[model samples]
Target chain A: MTSFFIYKAILVVVVFGIMLMAAMYSTYLERKVAAFIQDRVGPNRAGPFGILQPLADGIKMFMKEEIIPEVANKTLFIVGPCIAMLTAIMAGVVIPWGGELVINGVPYVLQIIDFDFGLLYVFGVVSLGVYGIMIGGWASNNKFSLFGAIRASAQMISYEIAMGLSIIALIMMTGTLSLREIVEFQAGGTGSTWNFWNVVYQPLGFLLFLVCAFAECNRTPFDLPESETELVGGYHTEYSSMKLGFYLFAEYINMFISSAVISTLYFGGTNFPFMNDLGLSQNAITILGTLAFFIKIGFFVFFYMWIRWTLPRFRYDQLMYLGWRVLIPLAIANVAITGLVMILTDRI
Target chain B: MKSLTGRAKVLDNPKMTFKERIYLPAIIGGITITLRHLFKRKATIRYPEEKRTFSPVWRGMHVLKRDDNGAERCTACGLCAVACPAEAITMTAAERKPGEEKLYREEKYAATYEINMLRCIFCGLCEEACPKEAIFLTDRLVSTDYARDGFIYGKDKLVEPVDKRVDVSKRQTPNVLEFKKIKHYRHNR
Candidate 1:
């Protein structure tokens, strides 16, 4: 029991370290993508094609002076970014990175904790992500910050409905809220055909989920909360130093979490096609599966950056209209269609 | 009012077509364009490491010329200073001393000459007005400095070095050489 606990502790530390490193590099990739789209050479100075740029950026962020507004709420002001960073990292807990790891003939499931309602827990934690922005904006005592906070909360609340409804259709198809179970159901056991990825069953649901994921993460087209042209620096207008860094870092972490979740749900997490036929050992298969999962996750992250550079920010009214009128109705219709199809097929 | 050129499209905001309303096709088009750019050669010329070649007629910084024998060509005739629109050129004329014929090609030479680069427009008017063919603008850019005093370029900066050569021949076109030839013929006559 003590050894198992120690393993879990080690896993937590490793996962945290990976998450932080991925988030740091995402900033560098974002700049490179932006430069490429504009036909310019991006950062290639700091340590060979700017690979060590994130280290330089971290040092700069740490070395900067921290500032707090005189009229700001001192306690919540500091708590805001901490909460943001905490909630962002918390969303990764129930996500399974691989199938299993066997050590000394004892098989251990490669997840932090396989909760019964893993999807619900993720959704709940992600929705709470808005509170950080809200508290930060309100505590700043600046109008722009307040406006940004309000916009973020409103947008998050509106999109959360569509996101939940989209997931509901998937739940009806899989009949399980545990993410690992969903993956297993789709994988169809070791040597089966790779025809059961959820995206084939839920295309419209995936689209709705994707759009809502963008809004939930406060990415472009839904990034009104911190739209530079309209709101200056928005919620972090008054924040400086590591506090600001924490807020920005939390955003990238949220992006990574959403990518992982999307890959898990639709792309069949850690289930590479024809893996069992390769005559590999259990440990090798497990390692390959983990690599495949990361590949899927990396593709989604690249897609996020691509869409961000391609699309322009939507107007406030258009944003709200899309979330409430368009996405919510489409998500509902998707759920209904899924149910009807399931019933007609006698699969229920 | 009627359109002047008959090329104006309607000003009314048209309703989006069904495909346009979905916006996916347009977004895909944009993504493809950016993806194309990602593979295209970047336009950024990394400065300091690489420099662009200047055009033949491009005038940059001033250089007081020397004849093939390395004698100063200026006679301090003040024509270039008179023609300078910015009043940037100033010189003091001195009679050629007894043993200084090897240094000065003319009986008179500019003893002290300066050009305030801060005021000079690099228009090549001084180059055009130099009767002795003393001053010409090369394709060399003036290096920036912190102090205004450093901008007043003296003879040490403007004159070509004795050992190292400065080529202002690119700025002297065929017409300019022809004019110089004609002037030399007139001086001989």
Candidate 2:
């Protein structure tokens, strides 16, 4: 038990480091990608290819003056970003990074937790993420901030239903709430007992989930809440110094976790095609699988930024229409069709 | 309303089709467009390291010229100061001493020549007004400085070095050169 605890502690630290690094570099990558798409050379000054940009940005954020509005609620304003960042990091605990690794006759899992209600935990955490924006916006005591907060909460609430409904179809097919189990269920290549990725089974569900994930992350096309033109600075209008950094950082982390969850649910987590067919040792295969999983996550994150640069933000009414009217119905139909297919094929 | 100008465009508020309403195809097209641009040549010149060349007739910083014997050409006739619309040029005349013939091309020279670059419009009128061909606008740019007083081009900043003469041959067009060859002009004598 002590050894198990030690391994888990190490895993936690490693995962935390990876998450922070990924989030920090995501900001740099966003600028570089934006510059490339616009036919301009981005930052290439600080370090080679601007690799040290994130560190410089972090330092600059820390050096900025911390401002707390006189009209704002002091305590909630402070608590808002903390909640946002905490919930963002907390969702990563349930994601399985890789398969099992054995050392000295003891098998250890790469995930932080394997609870049966892992999916529900992620959902609960994601739902709680809205409170950060809502509270921050309200605490600012400004009209634009309040409007942004309200829009954010409404958008998240409307889209969460669709996101949840989309997941339900996958859960029905997998018959398990544990993320590790779902990943394992999709293991093995062709001519094997297990199936391919869940995307093969539920393409519509995957599409719905992708769109909802974008909304939940408050990304472009679904980024009406913090639209800069409509709401100046949005929820973090009154926030400054590291406080604003935390809000922005939390968004990138949320994007990272959302990409991970999407890859896990639809792209078979760390399981790549012909992964088992290779005659490599168990440890080698596990390491390669972890790399493959990260590559999938990277692609998804790039796809998120790509979509962000490509699509303009949806109007307030159009956002609501898409969320409440379009997505929810489509997600419901997906769930029903998934059930129907399961029944017809006698897989249930 | 009746069109006042035929150039006015009448825009149609056409309803979106089913494909357009879906937005996926249009989104894909935009993505492909940006993807193509990602590989396209960047328009940035990366200033400081790479500078774009200016046009030959580009009027920039002023330079006081010299004759072939490396003597000051300006006789301080003050025509440039009079012709300057911005009233930027100022100078003081001094008689050339008997021993200073090597330094001065003429009997009179500008003892203190100054041009307030902040006031000058860079219209090349100074070059046109100089009877001695003593001042010309060079291709070199005026560097930025912290103080307004620093923009005042004194003799030290304006005069071309004796060892390294500034080439303003591009500003002297064929017509100006032809006019100079008339020799009837007092300075041309």
Candidate 3:
């Protein structure tokens, strides 16, 4: 058990390193996408096709002068992004990359650990994620920053309820809270019994889930917190250098993990059709599963960037109204329909 | 007045039906419309890799002019300075030196002329006011600097080199405010 913990710890470190690189590149991708949309030249220097742009940015950020506000809460300001980044990284542990691998006659799950309440675990981590933005904004002592933090806290907390409800509806259908069991439920080896993926059963639930995911993740149309026009850098207004970098990096990490969750939950979670009968080797099958999972996640990540450049952000009141009056009620109704259908079909 | 105290402030409300109350249909519809745009070969010029034609009319960095003989056309006539609305122009008239006839067309040529570009509004009134056709606004626009001092253009900065030429025939700059529709302001009487 101790050895397994060590391995999981190492895996966490490795995943975090990769996530760091990914978050930096997301910034690059964001800039490139923005430039292309607006018909302007983005960063194309520093390295070949600006592939080294992230590295340059990392170095620059590290070298930058740290600016602190005179009247701000010093310790909390520093801790805010740390909390955000930690929460973002923690969410990934519950997401099973592939079911498990048997090595040297020992079985080990692809996830860090098989938590029984993986869905709840994801929700719990995501809920805590808002505190980073809240503390950052409040600690900055700027009114604009405070306003942004308030928006973030309200927006995230509101959407999270709808998000949780949508997950509950999924749990009702899948009948499993564990990510591994959810993956297995979709895998068609149960005698041609898997009629369709969970999506077919819960299209409305999936839609609600994904939209709420976007709001919880706080992408555009929901990005009222960091609305550049109004907030002037938002929660990170008084932060500079590596502290600011942490806040920005936390956002992309959240985007990445949410994309992974959306992929795992809706799009069959590493389960592919007819790959088993194709007579492929076990290692090959595992690799294939990993590839499919990444393809789904990568597409969503790209979509997230694509939408940011395309849409204007929602107003604060409008966002609140949408969450409270629209999404929450819609989610409750979806739960009702899901429950009613399950009962009438005698599947309950 | 005593009876009116029982009444509360009224608020306007819109009635929503079953479908509207259950807004998944509309929200899904909104997502679908956006998804079409999300995939529609994004309407953008991937710039640097793909340079969009910045209209030849685009006002960018300005360049001064040299006459065809490479001699300055100004005869030290200070009409441009006087006509400038922004008070940008400044010059010192120097007497024509012997054997420098080909260099300057006038006996009284400007020895030192400087435009505090920070003050120059790029209005082209100075260009219109130049009787000698020396001071003119080029197709180029004003360049920018972080410091206030960088905006001041001396005679050395404003005068074009001998190799370069500005077409004497082409019209000077046009008024930007006049062309901008809807955002234009009308003088209140």
CA shift of B46, model 3, Å: 9.6
Off by over 4 Å in 2: B1-11, B173-175, B182-189
In order, what DockQ does each candidate have? 0.78, 0.79, 0.08
Docking class of 3: incorrect
Candidate numbers, best DockQ first, in rank order: 2, 1, 3
DockQ-wise, the better of 1 and 2 is: 2
RMSD of each: 2.2, 1.9, 8.3
Q: Which clashing pairs does model 3 show?
A: B60-B141
Quote the lDDT for A204 in model 2. 91
User: Of the candidates shown, which would achieve the greatest DockQ relative to the real structure?
Assistant: 2
Model 1 per-residue lDDT tens digits across residues B1-189: 679998998889989999998887998998898888888899998788889888888889999998998999988988889989999999999999999988999899999999999999999889988878899999999999999999999999998987877998798889887777774563312
Tens digits of per-residue lDDT, candidate 1, A1-348, equal 998999899889888998999999999998898898889988888998989999999999999999999999999999999999999999989999888899998888789989999999999999989999999999999999999999999999999999999999999999999999988877734444555689989999999999999999999988999998999988999999999999999999999999999999998888888776778898998899989899998888888888898899999999999999999999999999999999999999
| Candidate 1 lDDT (Cα, 0 to 1) | 0.91
TM-score of 2: 0.95
Which should have the higher DockQ, number 1 or number 3? Answer: 1
